[model samples]
Target: MLLNGRNAVVYGGGGSIGGAAARAFAREGARVFLAGRHPEPLQAVAEQIRSAGGLAETALLDALNQQAVNEHADDVASSAGSLDISLNVIQHGDVQGTPMSAMYLEDYLRPVSTAVQTTFITAQAAARHMMEQKSGVILAFGGSGTQEPGQYLGGLITAFEAIEAMRRQLAVELGPYGIRVVTLRSGGIPESLPSDMEGREEIAGAIQAATMLKRAATLEDVGNAAAFAASDMAASITAATINISAGALIDW
Candidate 1:
């Protein structure tokens, strides 16, 4: 019940991680607003939360639309008295598995561009509301990438880096207003995404073996972190980043 009576807006509430976070937030006593392009999935998550006697609602939206995002933020704040948390996990499918050299420039950078634009707009909309109330938490996601030559993960790495930077800057700018911006960076999550011909067990094992803890991050791990970030437990935590990659990071 860390988030009792709070109001939370989840931009990609239809996806696996987003849906998990939405449910977790609601379970903690927050009135959750699930927004996404897909109506059915968002509705399903809302229904589940409500069935559990939690406050949950669904909103059909294209997150990239700044005007719509702003309007939605206003509507939520109006209904809840004040917005407490905003998490953007919108999808931007511009990442093609091609390297910069051979990959068409258009396809190579599209995901980065789209993600930056949508996430920025959505965060800005929420920040404005949070600023008015002088309180809120903003959450975003990050990922890991292999550095092998020709491994080419498309532009996902670039996009994630940008997202991290944005979160840090937003944290600084919104700090005085009581809005905290942070990111939950993690390695591959297997609960929803299954492995392919490379072999599910092998790939998962390899990922675990590469991590310092000899294990991959779990959805529950992220959901818990997100809950804390949106709670008063993290009141003193802001302008910070938590790497939930199982120690799969090495800065050079």
Candidate 2:
């Protein structure tokens, strides 16, 4: 009941990670609003939450659309009386596995541009309402990727580092207003991989071997971390990035 009666908004709520967070928020007594481009998956997740006696609603939201995102935040605040938590897990269209040397210019720019745009749009929209309330949590995924030992990530790393930078700035600006901005970074969750993906087992094994725990973080782990961060228990945590990578990527 850490988030009892809280109003949480989750972007990309239909996806594995998003759905996990949304369910965790609801389980902790938050009324979750699931938003994404597609309604079928959104509805499916909502139904699951509802079946488990958790409050959930679905919305067709395009996080990249500034106007739509703003209106959605306004509506949620107005209807629920507050916007307690906001998390963005939308796909950044990152074309990974491609070497930068042979990668097209568009492929590299796609993730970088879209990640910054959607993140700013959703965070800004929620911050407006959160400022008025004088307290709220803005959660972001894909924490700082700059420290990761790799050159294979290409533009994906650039996007993650950019978001971490933005999270810091927002935390500084919103801190006085009692608003918290946090980022959750995972070294890569094994269960989050698509079932049809090729070499899935090999990739998952590599991820586990790289982690200090000898296991990749699970989708449930991300959800639990998110719920804790969004709750009052983590009130002292802000302007910080939480490492849920199971020591795969050291934070300091």
Candidate 3:
């Protein structure tokens, strides 16, 4: 019951990571508002949470739509009495597995722009409400790259670094209002891969072997980590990136 009586807004709540985190938030007592571009998948996650005896709701909207984001956030706050947690997990449409030298400029820059815009829009909407209440938690996700910058990640690493920088600045600005901004970094999760994806086994193996734990992080691990970070248990953790990569990111 870490989030009892709290309200959480999760953007991209229809996807694997977002759905998992939404369920975890509801399980721990937060009323979760799942917002994303697709209603079908969002409702699916909402059904799962409701079936588990938890409260959940869904809102279909593009994360890139600033006005829609602001309206939905306002509705949530007005209805629920507070906006306690905000997690932006939208897919940045990144094209990875390609070397930067040969990548298209659009491909290399898409994620950087999208990730920053969506994160800022959603976080700012939540921060406004959080500031009024004098407390809140803002969560973000990033690739965090390899130990020494290996190959094939393309603009994904840059996007993550940009997000990390934004998280630090947000923490500094929101600290006086009792709001915490944190980013979770992981090497990669095998469970999040599409079922019919090519080289699934090989990719999973590589990620597992790369990690010190000899296993890739799971959707459940990400969800649980998010719950902890959003809870008061991690009150002192802010303006920082929490490494859940199992040693995949050496500096962690």
Distance from true location, Cα of 188 in model 3, Å: 0.4
TM-score of each: 0.91, 0.97, 0.97
Each prediction's whole-model lDDT (CA) = 0.82, 0.92, 0.91
Ranked by TM-score from best down, the candidates are 2, 3, 1
- What's the TM for model 2? 0.97
> Which candidate model has the greater TM-score, 1 or 3?
3
Instruction: Give lDDT: candidate 1, residue 76.
Output: 93
Q: On a 0 to 100 scale, what is the lDDT of residue 30 in model 1?
A: 93
Roughly what TM-score does model 3 have, to 2 decimal places?
0.97
Q: Which stretches of candidate 1 lie over 4 Å from their true place?
A: 143-150, 194-203, 250-252
Instruction: List runs of model 2 lying over 4 Å from the truth.
Output: 146-151
**Pairs clashing within candidate 1:** none
- 98-158 per-residue lDDT for model 3 (tens digits): 7889899999999999999998999999999999999999999974565334547777888
